[model samples]
Target: MTDLHRLSIREITEGLSQAKFSSRELTEHYLKRIATLDGRVQSFVTVTPEQALAQADAADAALKSGTAGILTGVPIAHKDIFCTSGIKTTAGSKMLENFISPYDATVVAKGKVAGLVTLGKVNMDEFAMGSTSESSYFGATKNPWALDHVPGGSSGGSAAAVAADLAPFATGTDTGGSIRQPASFCGLTGLKPTYGRVSRFGMIAYASSLDQGGPMARSAEDCAYLMNVMAGHDAKDSTSIEKEADDYVANLNATAVKGLRIGIPKQYFNVAGLDAEVKARVEESLKKLQEMGATLVEIDLNMTESYVPTYYLIAPAEASSNLSRYDGVRYGYRCENPVDLTDLYKRSRSEGFGAEVQRRILIGTYALSAGYYDAYYVKAQKVRRLIQQDFLKAFESVDVIAAPSAPTTAYKIGASLDPVEMYLGDIYTIAVNLAGLPAINAPVGFDQDNLPVGLQLIGNYWSESQLLSVVHQYQQATDWHTQRAAIAEEKA
Candidate 1:
């Protein structure tokens, strides 16, 4: 039998049910892989080897007693942004470097109750601010595929970990294409669930309205498996929807694309910076969907041009407010020199945050300041509403919207220096978040450089199952999702 590292959560669960493999053995395999390869990838911030083994033992006992859940004994990784009780939960920022949460985030708590073993905490951009993992305070996470290139951010570590087989799957928070972009670059399937679909009780807030947590894995079916555990309601999160949770994996075999309306937004195709190869690959994916009985429709999302600027304004504005809790007096980092309270606040923040974080804080402060509120913040909110309205109208006529997840594939480290240029990479994905819609990124093909390209699928609010079904159908017909990074395969 193949090692547990090559099997999906579903496969591992089935094997565990039949007593073919002990949960402890599966957990040990992954822990050993992380210890061997993670040094080069730096995907994890904290590896909970002891906790994972303990949970695996408990899961093994449960299976022996005929008491096991769907995800029982599966090894998974959590993004550092999600808080875990008694575990160091750093949002990849110096501000919360040593902060330990007293309670688990709703997602973590739910995964634990479902009997899943947590591998560790994956790294991310500081406060989930950048498009590349380079913004991490700990260190930049090297792309497992090409060490010189970056696995996209702020969920770069999550994507890289799953792509590299460091973990079976990982959880990630997407504010503006964080999960999808990284998944695309890493050749994995990632879903940014509809806003408010998953509880955010202990997810360090990046942008209150845009931040969302979801699953990233080697395939769409694996993503669905993890989503089944992560998606649900929690009274702790005010924004959590009260709708009954559905089994996401139940519909993965539904390949009935007949009569499915797939909208091709013209604005996404015409973006100035989009690479020709990416466009060609997405078009090929569209052709494949059409062959599967999907009908492609041309649609216009006229407000697309303003997505980047509007997102920059709204996300940072909310981020500034959310990050204000990190003063020296609180849980995280404290400055040594402080003659008075004012000096304490200034020095603490000045030394704690990175350049990009500070820039956003300043921009957010300026935008929300007196006199500028109506001009900047209010206008951005209005634009956000318009983006949502556009999606609503489009969905009335189409089942899904498709586009390139990112303008290109994994870029070289430090390829994008200007913050604006980095933000523009998420143009196609941020709008879906702003509209509170579910979106997934699935590998479609490779570019001229052999880097993987991803196709973005956007579904209406609460339509994650539908999106997952479509992606699973596509993966069944294509080999892109199964294609591993050369370095990863070599290491395996």
Candidate 2:
């Protein structure tokens, strides 16, 4: 059982099946790691050792009785946005800090049926509205690659936990690159399935149209395994796709890179802000894919410049609507004293929400206001349709689109005080969400700072199987996915 923390999800399952170690043993190892390392990493908002052990014991018994699922006995962390019954699902905001969910999210429930154990709730941007983990009401999650640098936000804790070996693989929600960006910064594989491909029931909303849940793991193979359990439609989710779920694991092994056409967006490579080293790594990854028999076709994303503006307007407008339920009269945080109902609602939100969340709410409210709605909100939706059309047209000529996951490697947590700069970092990622297409971020190579760089693979809608297969093939040819952060290996 030595170095058990370093094993992949597949390896963990194999060892558990062979009785090499008990589920309790595996669970304890991770809990111990969290207790030992999380002080600096600060990834988990709440660690459920007792509940996790209980699940692990159940899994061990199932294994003995030949009733275990493929990932039975495996431990996974959930981003705090996903509701876990009786657990405090913070969504990294103080407004819901004490709000205990009465039910599990569809994703969590599915994982339970698959025999996966829950380790804890991980920190995230407040209401999943920020691009950096620093906005969490619980506090920021530090990157294991470099403690001062952020892991990436919203789903940053999930990425950091996996990257730091605090958990095997964790569930993360992607809204405009929350999962993929952090996965890129942390050197992990993070997938964002097409909109409706995964159930969002019980997962707190940021932007109803843009948010999607997926897995963040050590490699695409691990993601594929998790996706099998996570991708099915749920009757509870109105947004869930009604189609049958694909066998992601089978597709990962069956699909080959040869003859696959990967689109190279000229706009992505020509960006003035793209870091040279990060660009180099992206190019190197594409070259490797080409060597594996994939064709690299130069293409244009005509709506590239419109992505950021359209996303900011649409996402915030939806966020305003989704977050309005958190009034002082509701279940969340309320003001200590209020002279009137207006005072109650105003003070409660002002005190509960973080600065960034408040900023977005204001922007969203104004965009949705009667006088400006048509000019701002309506236009953004139109631009959003164009963005989706851009992807659809590109796919007509290429099977996948290749681009840099982030403009640069993970920077210091507080290095950028400018919100515009932060928004620009997501330039290459926001379009996929607008298009409702599946995409993944795979560690390609390291930049000069020794921080990891990610190569983003954008797939057509409902093409999770093919998207994952391509990353898996690339992973099989390289060691980037297998590389571990040094901080995780340090002795207590």
Candidate 3:
């Protein structure tokens, strides 16, 4: 039989329905792929083979009983940030290294209800702080295209897993550029839905206001399937949107790109450090979209350069507040033999959290400090509103905005030693989160290093269905989404 790992969600569901192969067989195929190839990519921190097979068995029974959901029996993995009941849900931090969640994250519970088999928890940045996956207490997830290069963080593990075909698709949380950046580096289609479109309860908070969970997969259609199960109103999560769940799959292949007004922010292309080749690839994709009848219009977003600073300030401020619970007094890592309460607090946090996480916490604490709150945090919020206003005005004349997902392709694992340079990796994607809009990063082409480049499509709030429709049309016209990394090819 053809390599089952390569088949998309649609194919897998159809195959199961036709009795061509049981869900158990499909699950086993992916489990085998993970066993053989995950070592090279280091994409997973944990692999629940037993749980996966059991879930597969249940999915098969559901299929036989004719009670299957669209994603029933389709295997997928969750980023470690989301709490998985009975599974260790470390957010790639030493603090939660052994914290097994008592309840499933709303996203996890919903996916399970849809019968999507859980593979395991994928790795991520410690508290989702870093721009590259390197900050994980579990070593950085390597890019499948090149073992030495970094996979974009903080959803790097999910991106690598899907890119290597270890899982058909995986959950990813975008705080700043977490999901989209890694997807760009790993050659996957990643969507960061508008804030609160997907519930945040049980998904470990990075910057509570900015964090959003979405899908990372080979095609937009797969994301649509996952979104159908993921998006909904969750009473448990106050931030969850109360709107009715969308039929993303039915509207995915929208008629065509005709009359789609795609806005290109002049500031994005003129950014100081954007790589020439990256610019070329993004422009080429735009040209292709134009050929498909979409019109490209140049627009100005004056707040473009402020995204990095504004996001860094606001995200860290929220993170400082959210992560305070990890002190030695409660759950998570506790210091042994503490001489005093203050010592216990200091040492446990110092020892448990990674360097990057601590750095952000410090920055956040300082930003939210009594003397500086108005100067830093409050001002950042104002700038954020200005950024949102910019998008609102742009969307008045355009349907979506287009840009390169990242400034360049994946860099060498430790090449960006300077924190400033590392933060700049998110220059292109941070704005979407700051504005609380939906954006997608779709694989466009390869760089000279054979690393994939992605073209980002940013849509107005609650426009995920429209964004997926546009991406589906683009993927149908191009073969970039079909290309696989050499490691995956070799294994196949």
Candidate 4:
């Protein structure tokens, strides 16, 4: 049971069943690590030691009675974006800083049902709005690989915690690459299920259409185990498709990418700002897959340039609508001594939301404003369809599209890039969300800076199982997935 922090969920569950360690012991191990290391990483918004231990005790009782399920007694940290009953559900914003959810989100509820012990709530970009997690009102999450660098966001806290071994695996949400980009920066595997593959009932709305909850973990197989618990239709979420999810871990080990048609978008490498080392790592990964008998086919996605603009327009428009409820009148933050209703609304939102969130709200409000809806929002929707059609057409010739997860690896924290520059970092990933497709971000290799570079695999709708299978095969062939940050390797 040495190096308990380094074990995957599979290993932890097996050890628990074999009586190698009690769930409380493992829970305390992670809580201890969080106490020691999280000050340096700043990954969690709230660390629930009391409730976590209580849950661990319950899991131990279940194990003794042979009532434990696959995820029983496993410790997991959740991105603060997911609503947890009684636990603070801050989407890394001051707006919800004091708000506590009265019920568990579908994802959180499922983990609780499976006997998973809650470690705490990790940090994120406010309203899932930024790339560096710097926008969090709680504070920025530093990368465990290098403290000066960002962990990527708005799931940066989730990525940082897992990278630092504060938790085995954590949940992350992908709203235009929040999960995948952070996993890419932190050197882990993250999956964004097909649009409706996972329920959004309790996930706070950033963009109802594009925001999706997913798993961020060390390897694809680990993600598969989580997917088994996380993915499924929920009657509570109208957007959640009425589809039965496949047993993600069932065919994981035996799955192969032989004869898999991997699409290479012609525009993937043509980005002016894409780093050369990042490009080299992705290309090398593709070559390795080629040697594994997978065929590479060049495909055109001419709509690549429109992804950023269209997504910005659409996500903000929806965000403006979703966030309107956060005024001073209802739950969340409120300004004191407001003179009137107008002042209350204006001051509360202005003071509560971070600068990035404010910027998006303004942009969204303007896009949906009278007389401008069709010119901007409507046309963006049209472009979104074009983007979706591009992928649908590519799927006709290829099984999955492969590209660099981000244009660059983790940048130094507080680099202070402009909003547009930050938005461009997601250029390779936003298109998948616009098309409502499943994608995986897996660590392929390290860049010149020694930061991890990810190779993103884009698959057709409901192709999560196939994507995980391909990544699992890749992990088997390479040791990159096994690499841990130096902080994780440091002895307790």
lDDT of 1 by residue, 1-492 (tens): 435677877788899999899999989888988998888899999999999999999999999998888788999999999999989999999998999999999999999999999999999999999888999999999888888889999999999898888899999999889999999999899999999899888999989988999999989899998889889888988899999877889878664677799999998899999999999999999999999899999998989988988988898899889889888996789899799999999999999999999999889988999999999999999999998898899988999999999998889987755877888888888998889899999998888777889999999988898999998988889999888876566443
What is candidate 4's lDDT per residue for 36-143, written digit by digit as tens?
A: 888999999999999999999999999999888978999999999999999999999999998899999999999999998999999999999999999999999999
Per-residue CA lDDT of model 2 for 194-303, tens digit only, reads 99999999999999999999999999999988999999878998989899998898888676799999999999999989999999999999999999999999999989
Q: TM-scores of all models? A: 0.98, 0.99, 0.99, 0.99
The RMSD (Cα, Å) of candidate 4 is 0.8
Best by lDDT: 4
What TM-score does model 1 achieve against the real structure?
Answer: 0.98
Stretch of 10 with least lDDT, candidate 4: 251-260
**Model 3 TM-score?**
0.99
Give the worst 10-residue stretch by lDDT in candidate 2.
483-492
lDDT tens readout by residue for model 3, 1-492: 548877888998899889899989988888888888888899999999999999999999999999998778989999999999999999999999999999999999999999999999999889899878899998989999999998889999999999888899999999888999999999999999998899999999988889999999999998999999889888998888888877999998754699899999999999888999999999999999999999999999999889989988999999999999999896999989999999999999999999999999999999999999999999999999999999999999999999999999999998846887888878889989988899999999998889999999999989999999999989999999989998777553
Worst 10 residues of 1 by lDDT: 483-492
Inter-residue clash pairs, candidate 1: none
Model 1 Cα shift for residue 213 (angstroms): 0.7
Q: Kindly report which residue pairs in candidate 2 clash with one another.
A: none
